[model samples]
Target: MEAKKRTKIIDVLGSTSVGTQVLVKGWVRTFRNNQFIALNDGSTINNIQGVVDFTTTDEKILKRITTGACISITGEVVESKGKGQSVEIKVDQLEILGDADADKYPLQPKRHSLEFLREIAHLRVRTNTFSAIYRMRHAMIFAVHKFFTEKGFFNIHTPIITGSDAEGAGEMFKVTNLDLENLPKTVEGHIDFKEDFFGKETNLTVSGQLEVETACMALSEVYTFGPTFRAENSNTSRHLAEFWMIEPEMAFYDINDNMDLAEEFLKYLTNYALDNCKDDLEFLNNRAVEEDKQKPQQERAEMTLLERLKFVVENDFVRLTYTEAIDILKNSKPNKKKKFQYLINEWGADLQSEHERYLVEKHFKKPVILCDYPKDIKAFYMRLNEDGKTVAAMDVLFPGIGEIIGGAQREERYDVLKGKIEKMGIPEEDLWWYMDLRKFGSAPHSGFGLGFERLMLFVTGMGNIRDVIPFPRTPDNAEF
Candidate 1:
C-alpha cells in the first residue's frame, strides 16, 4: 500500500471538496480553545483551522503543539464553522515533527514590532507581515522577468567582483587577499595594490550598468539583476551596506525612450502586486493605516495603499527638466518660508527627498520624471548636452520613494565619453575596455538602475528600507 500525498494548507483551505482525506503539513499559528488550531505553511496569508479532538488526543501531544511547532496532520476536509475561513480540517492524526519551547521561542502569538522582528530576522519570515511581504517580493520579481521577456530583453548575469568603479562614487568595499597585519607597502609608504588578488585592485561591484551595456551592444537589449555593495557608514533607514539592483540597457534608446520604459516598468510592477498579491496587499494596507494612526495628522498618508498603487498605474508621470523643477522649488512656499532642510535656491543643487516628495505628492500629485541634471552631479557615462553644463540624465520619482529609477542616454561618441571620463579624474587605464565599446560599432544606448529594496518598500508600504529586505546589511548591524 502507498501513502497519500501531502497537500499544502493553501490548497486544502481554498478547496470546497468536503469529506476528502488529505495529508497536511505546516507550523501551528495558534492553538485556540484546545479544540481548534490555526496552521500555516507560508503559502498564503490565511491559515487553515485544524479541529483537534482533545478528548482522544494525548495531553502530552497537545501540549507540544504550541506556536511555531512543526506538525503533520491527516484530516478530512469539511465546511468550516468559523467566520473568518471557509473550510477547515477535522484531524484524525496529529504528529509533532518539531516542538518550539514556549519559554524559549521569541515569536509567540502576538503582534511584534518591526524593530523587534528585525532582531529575530531568522524567524521573522514565519510571521504574517514578513510572509506577505516576501510573497509580494517574489511576485514582483516574476513580473519583472515576465515584462522584460515579453519585450524580448535578454537577462544577463554580470560579475559580482570587478576591477573598475562604474558609478565613480568611490564608496566600494575593497576585495583583497593580503596580509593586512603585516602590510605590503611601496617605497613611498603607500599600500602596493599591484600585489593584490586581482594584480592591481578590485572590489565588489557597485553597479552592473557598465558590464550590461557591453552586453546590450551585442544583444541589443539586456538587463542585469544582482547584488551590489557600498561601504558607506551611514545608519539611516534608507541606506544599506549591500543591496540588489536591476539595470537594463538598450542599444538604441534615447533619454525620452529610457523615461518611457522606466515609467511603464514601475506601473507594471505595482499593478502586478495588486493583481497577484491581493490578500497580502489588503493585510498590508490595513497594517499601514494602523501604523499611520500612531503618527501626527500631517504625517499620515492621504491615500490608502490600493489607491496609491492605482494612482501610479492609471496616471501619466509629470515630465520636466532639472531647470524647471528647480524653478518650481525656488518659488514654492517651503523655500520662501525656509522650511526646506536644504533650500532649493540654485539650479545645480541636487534635489533632496523632501523636494522630490513635494514635487510628486503635493505639486503634481503623481510620479515625476526630472531630467537634464547638471553633469557635475551625474555620472561621466551620461550624454553631455550641448549646453555644456547639463547631461541627458533622468530620475523617476515616485510618491513616497523618491528617485526610484535613475538613467540617461549614454555618451556613445568616443571623444565625448573619453573627455568626460578624463575630466572626472577616473583612471583611464582601468576602463580602457569600456572605451573600446565606444571606439567600435557602438550605437546610441541608454539604461537605468532600480534599487530592488526601495521598490519593495514602495510596494509593501514599509516605512524603513531595512524592513523590506530579508537580511539587511546596514551599518553596525548584520544579525542572522
Candidate 2:
C-alpha cells in the first residue's frame, strides 16, 4: 500500500475529503477513556480528536500514551459526533515518538497559572492560551510587513549592534570584548575602547530609528522591525530588557503626516487581527473575561478584548496639543483633574501614565493623540516647534493602556540638530554620519515606533508584558 501523506490538524479538520488515511503527528494534550486522545501541533488553538479502539489496542502501547508524550498516529478522517469540533481521527496505527512521565512533566491537562508557566516558558506554547497568543503574535508580525509593503515602504534590516545612542536614553546594553579583570586603560585612566572590538564603545541598539531614517532619506519610505535592548533595571510589568520595535521612517513628512501614518498603521494591524485570527481572538477574549473576574471591580477592564480591538477601528482618535491635554485634565467637566492625585499645572511636565489613561479611558473615552510635547521631555531628534519650547512629537494612546505608539518629526536643520546634540552633552563625533545627512540632503522626515510586545499586550489582553513575548528577558528572570 502507498503511504499516506501527513496533514496538518487545521487542514484535516476543515477537509471535506473524509474517510481517507492521513498521518497525524503531534504532542498529546490529553488521553481520556483509554480510547480518545486530544492532539495539537501548534497549528491553531483547537486540537484534533483521535479516537482509539482500546479493545483491539495493546495494553503496553496504551499505557505509554500519556500527556506531554510525542506520538504519531495514522488514522482515517471522519465527521466528528462530538461537540465543538468538525472532524476527528479514527486511529488504525499508533507509535510513541517520545514518552513523558505524567508526574515529571511540567504541563498536565489541568489549568496552569501564568506565573508557573513562565518557569517552563519552553512548554507554555502547548497550552491553549499561549498557542492562541502566539498565533496572533505571528499574524500581527505578518500584518506589519504587509501594511508597510502595500504602502510602498521597504523593509530595512537595521543593525543590532550600534555605535550611537539614537534615543539618547543612555539605557543601552554595552557590547565589548575587553576583559574586565585586565581591561585596556587610557592615559587618563579611563577604559580604552580603541583597542577593543569596533575600536570604540558600542552597545546593543536601543532603537533602529537613526539607521532607518538614513534609508528614508533615499528610499522615501523605509521601516525597521527588529530586536532592541535596554539595560534598565526596571522590574515593572511594562519594562523589558529586550524587545521588538516597529519603526517606520519617511522623508518629506511632518508631524501631522506622522500622526496620519501612525493611526492608519495601527488600525490596519488591528483589523487584520480581527479578520485573520478570529478563532484565536475568540479564545483570548474568553481568557481575558475570566482573568478579569479575579481582579477587583475597579481594576477590571471596561471593554472585552474583541470590544477593545473594535473600539480603535470603529472610533476616531482625538488629537490635541500637550498643553491642550493638560488644560482639559485640569478643567474638564466632572473634575477629572482634581481626582488625578497629582498636579498638572506645570507647562513642561511630562505626562505620566495616569494622565494618559485619563485622557483615553475616562475623559476622551477613545484613543487620543497628544501632540507637540515640551522639547525637554522628548528626544533630541524631534523637530523643535515654532514656540521653541515644544517638539513636534505625538503619542497614540489606547483605552486599556495609555501610550501604544510614539513618533516625531525629525529635526532637519543641521545647526539646530548640532546644537541639540551638543546641548545634551552627546559627543558630536559619535554621530558624525548622522550629522552628515543633515549637512548634505536632510529633508523633513518623521517616524514612529510601536513596541511590538506592547501591541501584543493590548491585542492579547495580557496583563504582564512578559506573557506576550515567547522568551521574556526581565530584570532578574533570564531562565530558558
Candidate 3:
C-alpha cells in the first residue's frame, strides 16, 4: 500500500480534523511521562503532544525519542485532554528518522541565555526565542514591501559595488580583487587604484539613496531595499558591519512630506505584525517580560512589547527642530548634573545616543522627529535651510532605539550641490552623474534610510541587533 501523505505539524495541531490518519514529522522537544512526546516542526512555537502506548511500544524506540531527535509519527488526530494544547496525535506508529544524542546535543529543553545562543548561531533558530524572532522578521520584511507597493512606489535594485560615497561619511568597506601580497604602486609609491578591477577605487555601497533618487526623478516615487556595508570598527550592540537598509526617494516632497511617509510606514508595519504574527509576537512579548524580571527595576521597559508597538501605531510622533532638541538636552538633568558622557553644551553639537534616548524616552515620552540639523553636522546632499547655517535633515528617534530613520530633503540646485560637494572635498568627477540629475531636471525631493535590523530590534524587543538578523556580520566576527 502507498504510504500516507505527510502533513505539517502546524496544520495537524491547528485543525479539528479528527479520526484522520496523518503523518507528522518534527524534532522532539521533550519526551514527557515516558509515553507522551512534544513535537515541533518550526511551523509554530507551540508543540503538539504525541501519545504512545508504553505497554506495546518497544523500549528501544521510546529511548531514542530524546530532545532534538527527528521523528516521523503516523497517528490519528484527536481532541487532546492536555491543559495548554487543544489537540494531539494518538500515535499508531513511531519511527526515529534521526537520533540526537541527549548527552551531546547542545540545546536542551531549558532556558538559554541570548549570548550562549549566539555562539551556536546555526542551531539557535530552533529555539523558541530565535524562531519567534525570525518569524517576525519575515513578517516585517513583507510589510515593508507591501506598504511601498500599495503606495505605487517602484522597487528599484541598486548596484552593490560602486565608486561613489553617497553619505560622504568615508566609512566604506573597500572592494577589490587585487592581490594584497603583490604591490601596485605609482611613482610616488602610493597604491595605485587604477590597477583595480573598476579602474578606480570601488567599495561596497553604504546607501542606495543616491541611485534611488535618479529613479524617483522619473518614477515620481522609488525605493531600494538591499544590503549596505560600513567599515566602522565599533563593536557595540547596535552596530553591524553589514546590514539591510530601506531608502525611499520621492519627487515633489519636502522635509515634512518625508516625515509623514516615514511615520505612516512605521505605523503600518507595527499594525501588520500585530495582525499577521500574533502568536510569535505574544511569545516574544512574554519572553521579554521574563527577561526583564532579572534586571533592576529602573532598567526594565516601562511598557510591554505589545503595548509599545501599539503605542507607536496609535499615537502621533512629536516633531521639533534640532535647535529645540539641543535646548531641551542642555537643560535636562543629565546635562545639568554632568551625567551624560558627551554633554550637550552647544546648539550645533551633534546629539549622541544617550541624548537621543533622553529626548525620546524621557523628554517627549513618544517617538520624536527632530529636523533642521546644523548644516556642518549633516551630509553634503542635504538641502540647506534659508539661514545657510542648517540643513533640512530629520531623524526619527524611538524610545529604546535611537535614530531609527535618518533622511533629509535633498539639495536640488546644481550650483549649490556642486559647491557643497567641493566644500566637503568630495570628488566632483566621481559624482558628475549625481550632479546631472540636478542639472537637467531638478525637483524638490526628500528621502530617508531606515535600518532594517534596527526596526527588527524594536518590533521584536531584542536588545542586540545580532539576535534579530539571521546571520549577523560585525567587527572581527563572521561565523555562521
Q: After superposition, how far is residue 150 of candidate 3 from its true place, in Å?
A: 0.5
Model 2 per-residue lDDT tens digits across residues 1-480: 223777888888776367778898899999999998999888877889999999999999999999999999998888889998888989999999999998899898888999999999999998999999989999999999999999999999999999998888898898999898999999999999998989999999999999998899999999999999999999888999999999999999989999999999999999999999998999999988998899999888889999999999998999999999988877755344376656676678777778888899888888999999999989999999998999999999997778999999999999999999999999988888888899887899999999999999988889899899999998888888
The list of candidate 1 runs beyond 4 A from truth reads: 1-3
Model 1 vs. true fold: TM: 0.98
Candidate lDDT scores, in order, read: 0.91, 0.91, 0.91
**Residue 355: error of model 2 in Å?**
1.4
Give the true-structure RMSD of model 3: 1.5
Runs with alpha carbons beyond 4 Å of true place in candidate 3: 1-3
Question: Ten residues in a row with the worst lDDT in model 1?
Answer: 1-10
- Looking at candidate 1, what is the lDDT of residue 34? 86
Candidate 3, lDDT over the whole model: 0.91
TM-scores for all candidates: the values are: 0.98, 0.97, 0.97
> Per-residue CA lDDT of candidate 3, range 146-168, in tens?
99999999999999999888888
* Residue 428's lDDT in candidate 3: 91
